[model samples]
Target: MTDTGMTAPEPTAIDETRQRELQILSEDAVLKGHPHGDEQCKNCLYYLDVDEAISYCWHPKLRVLVGQDWYCQWWEEITAEA
Candidate 1:
């Protein structure tokens, strides 16, 4: 994890063949930061909102407390159950 204004850490190496599989899983959860548009982390399946502003996401690579409205490329809409 890194502090604000710091460059993100180098990405973990993954098998190219499993890229799609990994993406699907990563998108299923959400991360913290400024939201990518209206894709708030609070609406994500992996978001654990601690309050109105503070929240945590079950990210595959990063696990840090963040604002509820934060988002990343791995953002995915929360699916509803039938």
Candidate 2:
């Protein structure tokens, strides 16, 4: 997979409006901004960078912009074939 130098989003960088529009999960709900063991958005199968500090979660249930370090219950490890 292509690397886009993804990083965590700044606190003010998150688009609250867009987040609400998409009904993105709350940080608490998704366990975001915290790593689950070695799992994170940057290493998940659904993550796609939108910019250096922002990415899109392509998971059907998410489909929201996320930070590289964000983690969710749906987090899936990216395989070599992905």
Candidate 3:
């Protein structure tokens, strides 16, 4: 049998397509420069990446995509990811 350890199964064609669509992006959106990086997104008073494009106080529901580096004044780092 071939060595499975060396080469993991690649994502299915459909899974690959979906992942490409789900990956972080900054299109027609702002790449916010967070003073706290991940800290901000995770600790914002209202943090949620649901179906809607979220923000500290702006961003309409499902109107825009959030940049991974986006941040606002209402940011905090409660955990390592934040």
Candidate 4:
């Protein structure tokens, strides 16, 4: 018997507007240079380089986009927020 575990579909609607929004998010909250008092968005679980837009987060692969700043649920902290 094949064990076919149900899985959430990948995100697909990540268009230019979405990308821009997320980019703004990263710039505002993630890259605000808050002093590194906490983790930056770059190191979070949702954080992905511009090259790997096709990649999907294991926890909640539903919400996706090219850039990493795209917010979701499975995000993790790498360092304190600046």
Report the number of the highest-TM-score candidate.
Answer: 2
Candidate 3 total steric clashes: 2
TM-score of each: 0.49, 0.61, 0.32, 0.26
Q: What is the C-alpha lDDT of each candidate?
A: 0.62, 0.75, 0.46, 0.47
Give the Å shift of residue 56 in candidate 4: 1.4
> Mind sharing the TM-score for model 2?
0.61
Query: How do the candidates rank by lDDT, highest first?
Result: 2, 1, 4, 3
Candidate 1 per-residue C-alpha lDDT over 1-82 given as tens digits, one digit per residue, 9 for 90 to 100: 5568977666455665466665654465443346776877776666766355777666655465556877766656777860
Return the TM-score for candidate 1, rounded to 2 decimals. 0.49
What does candidate 3's lDDT look like per residue over 1-82, in tens digits? Answer: 8766787667799998866654443322333555354544434434555234443333332233344455644444445553
For model 3, state the Cα shift of residue 77 in Å: 13
lDDT per residue for candidate 2 within 1-82, as digits (tens), equals 7778998566553576766645545643465677788988888898887354668888887777788887889988788998
Model 3 TM-score on a 0 to 1 scale: 0.32
Clashing pairs in 3: 38-82, 39-82
RMSD of each: 10.3, 12.4, 9.5, 13.4
Best by lDDT: 2
What is the C-alpha lDDT profile of model 4 across 8-66, one tens digit per residue? 67656677677788677555443342224344334565555525644543434333333
What are the runs in model 2 whose C-alpha is more than 4 Å off? Answer: 1-24, 27-29
Candidate 3: residue 44 lDDT (0-100): 47
By how many angstroms RMSD does model 2 differ from the true structure?
A: 12.4
